[model samples]
Target: MPNSSPKFSYIDYNAQTVTIKRLRQLSRLLDTVITVPGTPIAIGLDPIIGFIPIGGDVLGLILSSYIVYEASRLGVPKKLLSRMIFNIIIDSLLGSFPIIGDLFDFAWTANHYNIKLLEKHLNGY
Candidate 1:
Protein backbone atom coordinates (compact mmCIF):
# COMPACT_ATOMS: atom_id res chain seq x y z
CA MET A 1 0.00 0.00 0.00
CA PRO A 2 1.11 3.60 -0.65
CA ASN A 3 1.89 5.95 2.18
CA SER A 4 -1.05 8.08 3.17
CA SER A 5 0.75 11.41 3.09
CA PRO A 6 3.14 10.97 0.17
CA LYS A 7 6.20 9.12 -1.02
CA PHE A 8 7.72 12.26 -2.47
CA SER A 9 8.25 15.75 -1.16
CA TYR A 10 7.70 19.08 -2.84
CA ILE A 11 10.19 21.87 -3.28
CA ASP A 12 9.46 25.53 -3.93
CA TYR A 13 11.49 25.86 -7.11
CA ASN A 14 11.05 29.63 -7.29
CA ALA A 15 11.46 30.26 -3.58
CA GLN A 16 15.01 31.54 -3.66
CA THR A 17 17.50 28.72 -3.87
CA VAL A 18 20.97 29.91 -4.85
CA THR A 19 21.40 26.59 -6.61
CA ILE A 20 18.61 27.75 -8.87
CA LYS A 21 20.53 30.92 -9.60
CA ARG A 22 23.75 29.04 -10.33
CA LEU A 23 21.84 26.58 -12.46
CA ARG A 24 20.40 29.48 -14.42
CA GLN A 25 23.84 30.97 -14.89
CA LEU A 26 25.23 27.61 -15.89
CA SER A 27 22.36 27.18 -18.30
CA ARG A 28 22.16 30.75 -19.68
CA LEU A 29 18.64 30.25 -21.05
CA LEU A 30 17.34 33.74 -20.45
CA ASP A 31 16.27 36.11 -23.20
CA THR A 32 17.70 39.61 -23.74
CA VAL A 33 21.24 38.11 -23.89
CA ILE A 34 22.43 41.03 -21.79
CA THR A 35 25.82 42.47 -22.63
CA VAL A 36 28.00 45.50 -22.07
CA PRO A 37 26.67 48.38 -24.15
CA GLY A 38 29.50 48.20 -26.62
CA THR A 39 30.97 44.79 -25.93
CA PRO A 40 31.16 42.29 -28.75
CA ILE A 41 28.95 39.20 -28.39
CA ALA A 42 31.74 36.80 -29.35
CA ILE A 43 33.23 36.66 -25.83
CA GLY A 44 31.13 35.65 -22.80
CA LEU A 45 30.78 33.19 -19.91
CA ASP A 46 30.95 30.10 -22.14
CA PRO A 47 34.66 30.65 -22.50
CA ILE A 48 35.09 32.87 -19.49
CA ILE A 49 34.02 30.06 -17.20
CA GLY A 50 36.60 27.88 -18.93
CA PHE A 51 39.42 30.20 -17.93
CA ILE A 52 39.66 28.62 -14.49
CA PRO A 53 43.15 27.17 -14.99
CA ILE A 54 42.88 23.41 -15.62
CA GLY A 55 39.46 22.11 -14.65
CA GLY A 56 37.39 25.24 -14.82
CA ASP A 57 36.02 24.79 -18.32
CA VAL A 58 35.57 21.06 -17.85
CA LEU A 59 33.69 21.70 -14.63
CA GLY A 60 31.44 24.14 -16.39
CA LEU A 61 30.77 21.55 -19.06
CA ILE A 62 29.99 18.93 -16.43
CA LEU A 63 27.54 21.25 -14.74
CA SER A 64 25.88 21.94 -18.06
CA SER A 65 25.26 18.20 -18.48
CA TYR A 66 22.89 18.26 -15.54
CA ILE A 67 20.22 19.87 -17.65
CA VAL A 68 20.50 17.12 -20.22
CA TYR A 69 20.31 14.55 -17.46
CA GLU A 70 17.13 16.17 -16.27
CA ALA A 71 15.75 16.02 -19.78
CA SER A 72 16.63 12.33 -20.00
CA ARG A 73 14.82 11.72 -16.75
CA LEU A 74 11.88 13.44 -18.33
CA GLY A 75 11.96 10.76 -21.08
CA VAL A 76 13.48 12.68 -23.98
CA PRO A 77 14.28 10.31 -26.87
CA LYS A 78 17.66 8.63 -27.15
CA LYS A 79 18.34 10.02 -30.63
CA LEU A 80 17.69 13.55 -29.50
CA LEU A 81 19.63 12.87 -26.31
CA SER A 82 22.59 11.83 -28.45
CA ARG A 83 22.44 15.16 -30.18
CA MET A 84 22.38 16.94 -26.84
CA ILE A 85 25.35 14.91 -25.67
CA PHE A 86 27.15 15.76 -28.87
CA ASN A 87 26.59 19.44 -28.28
CA ILE A 88 28.12 19.17 -24.84
CA ILE A 89 31.02 17.19 -26.26
CA ILE A 90 31.79 19.75 -28.93
CA ASP A 91 31.50 22.53 -26.40
CA SER A 92 33.70 20.75 -23.87
CA LEU A 93 36.30 19.67 -26.41
CA LEU A 94 36.51 23.04 -28.07
CA GLY A 95 36.31 24.70 -24.69
CA SER A 96 39.36 22.74 -23.49
CA PHE A 97 41.66 24.75 -25.71
CA PRO A 98 43.89 27.30 -24.07
CA ILE A 99 42.99 30.98 -24.61
CA ILE A 100 40.73 30.31 -27.55
CA GLY A 101 38.57 27.83 -25.65
CA ASP A 102 37.40 30.31 -23.05
CA LEU A 103 36.54 32.69 -25.83
CA PHE A 104 34.58 29.93 -27.51
CA ASP A 105 32.59 29.26 -24.38
CA PHE A 106 31.62 32.90 -24.38
CA ALA A 107 30.52 32.72 -27.98
CA TRP A 108 28.86 29.31 -28.11
CA THR A 109 26.18 28.11 -25.72
CA ALA A 110 25.52 24.36 -25.32
CA ASN A 111 22.99 24.83 -22.53
CA HIS A 112 20.86 27.06 -24.68
CA TYR A 113 20.68 24.22 -27.18
CA ASN A 114 19.75 21.74 -24.46
CA ILE A 115 17.00 24.05 -23.27
CA LYS A 116 15.73 24.39 -26.79
CA LEU A 117 15.78 20.65 -27.24
CA LEU A 118 13.59 20.28 -24.17
CA GLU A 119 11.22 22.95 -25.32
CA LYS A 120 10.83 21.30 -28.69
CA HIS A 121 10.33 17.90 -27.11
CA LEU A 122 7.74 19.33 -24.76
CA ASN A 123 5.81 20.92 -27.59
CA GLY A 124 5.94 17.57 -29.42
CA TYR A 125 6.44 19.01 -32.88
Candidate 2:
Protein backbone atom coordinates (compact mmCIF):
# COMPACT_ATOMS: atom_id res chain seq x y z
CA MET A 1 0.00 0.00 0.00
CA PRO A 2 1.08 3.59 -0.70
CA ASN A 3 1.86 5.98 2.14
CA SER A 4 -0.92 8.45 2.88
CA SER A 5 1.01 11.17 4.71
CA PRO A 6 1.41 14.42 2.82
CA LYS A 7 4.86 15.37 1.60
CA PHE A 8 6.60 18.65 2.38
CA SER A 9 8.87 18.82 -0.65
CA TYR A 10 8.04 22.44 -1.26
CA ILE A 11 8.68 23.60 2.29
CA ASP A 12 12.01 25.29 2.76
CA TYR A 13 13.26 24.72 6.27
CA ASN A 14 16.32 26.92 5.75
CA ALA A 15 14.22 29.86 4.73
CA GLN A 16 11.95 29.29 7.68
CA THR A 17 14.96 29.22 9.98
CA VAL A 18 16.24 32.52 8.67
CA THR A 19 12.83 34.12 8.98
CA ILE A 20 12.36 32.89 12.53
CA LYS A 21 15.81 34.09 13.47
CA ARG A 22 15.07 37.56 12.19
CA LEU A 23 11.76 37.62 13.99
CA ARG A 24 13.43 36.54 17.23
CA GLN A 25 15.96 39.35 16.94
CA LEU A 26 13.18 41.85 16.31
CA SER A 27 11.23 40.59 19.29
CA ARG A 28 14.23 40.85 21.57
CA LEU A 29 15.03 44.32 20.38
CA LEU A 30 11.49 45.51 20.84
CA ASP A 31 10.83 43.80 24.14
CA THR A 32 13.97 43.48 26.24
CA VAL A 33 17.66 44.41 26.26
CA ILE A 34 18.54 47.59 28.16
CA THR A 35 18.95 47.47 31.91
CA VAL A 36 16.96 49.88 34.08
CA PRO A 37 20.08 50.95 36.07
CA GLY A 38 19.25 50.71 39.78
CA THR A 39 16.77 47.93 39.07
CA PRO A 40 16.78 44.37 37.76
CA ILE A 41 14.30 45.03 34.98
CA ALA A 42 15.17 45.44 31.33
CA ILE A 43 13.32 47.18 28.51
CA GLY A 44 13.70 47.86 24.79
CA LEU A 45 12.38 49.94 21.93
CA ASP A 46 8.79 49.09 22.69
CA PRO A 47 8.63 51.26 25.78
CA ILE A 48 11.05 53.80 24.37
CA ILE A 49 8.86 54.29 21.33
CA GLY A 50 5.80 54.45 23.53
CA PHE A 51 7.14 57.81 24.63
CA ILE A 52 6.26 59.23 21.21
CA PRO A 53 2.48 59.54 21.09
CA ILE A 54 0.14 57.78 18.68
CA GLY A 55 2.99 56.98 16.34
CA GLY A 56 4.85 54.81 18.81
CA ASP A 57 2.16 52.24 19.35
CA VAL A 58 1.31 52.32 15.68
CA LEU A 59 4.85 51.44 14.77
CA GLY A 60 4.86 48.64 17.29
CA LEU A 61 1.60 47.29 15.87
CA ILE A 62 3.00 47.35 12.38
CA LEU A 63 6.15 45.47 13.34
CA SER A 64 4.25 42.91 15.37
CA SER A 65 1.70 42.46 12.59
CA TYR A 66 4.49 41.27 10.33
CA ILE A 67 5.14 38.36 12.65
CA VAL A 68 1.47 37.39 12.54
CA TYR A 69 1.47 37.63 8.78
CA GLU A 70 4.52 35.37 8.57
CA ALA A 71 2.93 32.86 10.88
CA SER A 72 -0.16 32.71 8.71
CA ARG A 73 2.02 32.11 5.70
CA LEU A 74 3.76 29.27 7.52
CA GLY A 75 0.44 27.50 8.04
CA VAL A 76 -0.21 28.23 11.68
CA PRO A 77 -3.58 27.04 12.93
CA LYS A 78 -6.53 29.41 13.27
CA LYS A 79 -6.69 29.13 17.07
CA LEU A 80 -3.03 29.99 17.42
CA LEU A 81 -3.37 32.87 15.01
CA SER A 82 -6.33 34.20 17.01
CA ARG A 83 -4.29 34.01 20.19
CA MET A 84 -1.43 35.82 18.54
CA ILE A 85 -3.81 38.57 17.42
CA PHE A 86 -5.19 38.83 20.92
CA ASN A 87 -1.70 39.39 22.30
CA ILE A 88 -1.01 42.14 19.80
CA ILE A 89 -4.36 43.79 20.53
CA ILE A 90 -3.75 43.69 24.25
CA ASP A 91 -0.29 45.14 23.87
CA SER A 92 -1.45 47.88 21.53
CA LEU A 93 -4.49 48.84 23.63
CA LEU A 94 -2.77 48.80 26.98
CA GLY A 95 0.44 50.27 25.68
CA SER A 96 -1.40 53.34 24.45
CA PHE A 97 -1.98 54.86 27.85
CA PRO A 98 0.15 57.60 29.33
CA ILE A 99 3.00 56.79 31.70
CA ILE A 100 1.40 53.52 32.64
CA GLY A 101 1.29 52.44 29.03
CA ASP A 102 5.03 52.66 28.66
CA LEU A 103 5.38 50.46 31.67
CA PHE A 104 2.86 48.08 30.17
CA ASP A 105 4.76 47.95 26.93
CA PHE A 106 7.91 47.10 28.76
CA ALA A 107 6.21 44.21 30.46
CA TRP A 108 3.79 42.98 27.80
CA THR A 109 6.26 41.70 25.16
CA ALA A 110 3.61 40.64 22.66
CA ASN A 111 6.11 39.92 19.91
CA HIS A 112 7.93 37.48 22.14
CA TYR A 113 4.68 35.80 23.08
CA ASN A 114 3.59 35.49 19.48
CA ILE A 115 6.89 33.94 18.51
CA LYS A 116 6.47 31.38 21.24
CA LEU A 117 3.03 30.58 19.90
CA LEU A 118 4.46 30.16 16.43
CA GLU A 119 7.15 27.85 17.73
CA LYS A 120 4.61 25.81 19.64
CA HIS A 121 2.37 25.46 16.63
CA LEU A 122 5.25 24.45 14.42
CA ASN A 123 6.34 21.84 16.94
CA GLY A 124 2.83 20.35 16.88
CA TYR A 125 2.12 21.30 20.47
Candidate 3:
Protein backbone atom coordinates (compact mmCIF):
# COMPACT_ATOMS: atom_id res chain seq x y z
CA MET A 1 0.00 0.00 0.00
CA PRO A 2 1.14 3.57 -0.73
CA ASN A 3 1.48 6.19 1.98
CA SER A 4 -1.74 8.19 2.29
CA SER A 5 -0.84 10.71 4.98
CA PRO A 6 -1.27 14.33 3.99
CA LYS A 7 1.66 16.66 4.45
CA PHE A 8 1.94 20.39 4.97
CA SER A 9 5.40 21.35 3.89
CA TYR A 10 4.95 24.98 4.90
CA ILE A 11 4.08 24.10 8.48
CA ASP A 12 7.10 24.14 10.70
CA TYR A 13 6.17 21.96 13.63
CA ASN A 14 9.68 22.04 15.01
CA ALA A 15 9.47 25.79 15.39
CA GLN A 16 7.15 25.29 18.32
CA THR A 17 9.28 24.12 21.18
CA VAL A 18 7.93 22.49 24.33
CA THR A 19 8.39 25.74 26.22
CA ILE A 20 6.37 27.60 23.61
CA LYS A 21 3.56 25.08 23.86
CA ARG A 22 3.49 25.36 27.63
CA LEU A 23 3.58 29.13 27.47
CA ARG A 24 0.70 29.23 25.01
CA GLN A 25 -1.38 27.01 27.24
CA LEU A 26 -0.52 29.07 30.31
CA SER A 27 -1.36 32.28 28.51
CA ARG A 28 -4.77 30.99 27.50
CA LEU A 29 -5.44 29.75 31.01
CA LEU A 30 -4.60 33.15 32.41
CA ASP A 31 -6.38 35.27 29.83
CA THR A 32 -9.19 33.75 27.80
CA VAL A 33 -10.25 30.33 29.02
CA ILE A 34 -13.74 31.36 30.02
CA THR A 35 -16.53 33.17 28.21
CA VAL A 36 -19.03 35.61 29.67
CA PRO A 37 -22.61 34.52 29.15
CA GLY A 38 -24.60 36.58 26.69
CA THR A 39 -21.43 38.41 25.73
CA PRO A 40 -18.61 37.98 23.28
CA ILE A 41 -15.98 38.84 25.88
CA ALA A 42 -13.90 36.17 27.50
CA ILE A 43 -11.85 36.10 30.69
CA GLY A 44 -9.54 33.85 32.65
CA LEU A 45 -8.40 33.01 36.14
CA ASP A 46 -6.14 36.02 36.35
CA PRO A 47 -9.05 38.36 36.92
CA ILE A 48 -11.24 35.92 38.79
CA ILE A 49 -8.45 35.28 41.22
CA GLY A 50 -7.81 38.96 41.60
CA PHE A 51 -11.05 39.15 43.55
CA ILE A 52 -9.29 37.54 46.51
CA PRO A 53 -7.56 40.76 47.55
CA ILE A 54 -3.80 41.20 47.98
CA GLY A 55 -2.74 37.60 47.61
CA GLY A 56 -4.60 37.17 44.36
CA ASP A 57 -2.87 40.07 42.67
CA VAL A 58 0.49 38.82 43.89
CA LEU A 59 -0.20 35.36 42.53
CA GLY A 60 -1.28 36.80 39.20
CA LEU A 61 1.92 38.82 39.03
CA ILE A 62 3.97 35.76 39.77
CA LEU A 63 2.27 33.76 37.02
CA SER A 64 2.64 36.58 34.54
CA SER A 65 6.30 36.98 35.47
CA TYR A 66 6.93 33.34 34.69
CA ILE A 67 6.16 34.03 31.05
CA VAL A 68 8.88 36.66 30.94
CA TYR A 69 11.27 34.27 32.62
CA GLU A 70 10.53 31.63 30.01
CA ALA A 71 10.96 34.18 27.26
CA SER A 72 14.39 35.07 28.59
CA ARG A 73 15.30 31.40 28.65
CA LEU A 74 14.19 31.20 25.03
CA GLY A 75 16.87 33.81 24.17
CA VAL A 76 14.57 36.70 23.53
CA PRO A 77 16.54 39.93 23.31
CA LYS A 78 16.86 42.01 26.44
CA LYS A 79 14.98 44.87 24.81
CA LEU A 80 12.00 42.71 24.04
CA LEU A 81 12.20 41.14 27.48
CA SER A 82 12.00 44.59 28.99
CA ARG A 83 8.81 45.22 27.08
CA MET A 84 7.36 42.01 28.45
CA ILE A 85 8.36 43.04 31.95
CA PHE A 86 6.69 46.37 31.38
CA ASN A 87 3.48 44.64 30.49
CA ILE A 88 3.60 42.73 33.76
CA ILE A 89 4.33 45.88 35.68
CA ILE A 90 1.44 47.71 34.11
CA ASP A 91 -0.88 44.82 34.75
CA SER A 92 0.24 44.62 38.34
CA LEU A 93 -0.08 48.33 39.00
CA LEU A 94 -3.50 48.81 37.49
CA GLY A 95 -4.69 45.47 38.74
CA SER A 96 -3.90 46.44 42.33
CA PHE A 97 -6.87 48.73 42.42
CA PRO A 98 -9.96 47.48 44.20
CA ILE A 99 -12.97 46.86 41.99
CA ILE A 100 -11.62 48.69 38.97
CA GLY A 101 -8.49 46.58 38.91
CA ASP A 102 -10.44 43.37 38.63
CA LEU A 103 -12.32 44.89 35.72
CA PHE A 104 -9.05 45.89 34.10
CA ASP A 105 -7.78 42.34 34.31
CA PHE A 106 -10.53 41.33 31.94
CA ALA A 107 -8.95 43.56 29.32
CA TRP A 108 -5.25 43.73 30.18
CA THR A 109 -4.33 40.06 29.74
CA ALA A 110 -0.62 40.56 30.37
CA ASN A 111 0.18 36.90 29.82
CA HIS A 112 -1.44 36.94 26.40
CA TYR A 113 0.38 40.16 25.51
CA ASN A 114 3.71 38.76 26.68
CA ILE A 115 3.20 35.58 24.68
CA LYS A 116 2.70 37.69 21.58
CA LEU A 117 5.94 39.48 22.28
CA LEU A 118 7.75 36.20 22.76
CA GLU A 119 6.33 34.79 19.51
CA LYS A 120 7.31 37.90 17.56
CA HIS A 121 10.83 37.58 18.88
CA LEU A 122 10.97 33.90 17.99
CA ASN A 123 9.63 34.59 14.50
CA GLY A 124 12.39 37.19 14.02
CA TYR A 125 9.95 40.07 13.98
The best candidate by TM-score is: 2
lDDT, each prediction: 0.67, 0.87, 0.88
- Cα RMSD to the true fold for all candidates: 5.3, 4.4, 8.6
RMSD of 3: 8.6
Model 1 lowest lDDT segment of ten: 7-16
Write down the TM-score of every candidate. 0.70, 0.86, 0.85
Model 1 per-residue lDDT tens digits across residues 40-111: 553345566577887777676677788777666556689988999998998899889888776667666888
RMSD of 1: 5.3
**Which regions in candidate 3 have their CA more than 4 angstroms from the true location?**
1-16
Candidate 2 residue-wise lDDT, 1-125, digit = tens: 86675644366889888988988888888888688899988788888988998998899889889999888877777888999999999999999999998888988989999999898877778
| Per-candidate clash tally | 6, 0, 0
Candidate number with greatest lDDT: 3
Q: What lDDT score is found at residue 120 in candidate 3? A: 81
Please provide, for model 3 over 15-124, each residue's C-alpha lDDT reduced to its tens digit, 9 standing for 90 to 100. Answer: 55788999999999999999989999999999999999799999999999999987876667799999999999999999999999989999998899899888887887
Q: Could you tell me which 10 consecutive residues in candidate 3 have the lowest summed lDDT?
A: 7-16
Pairwise lDDT winner, candidates 2 and 3: 3
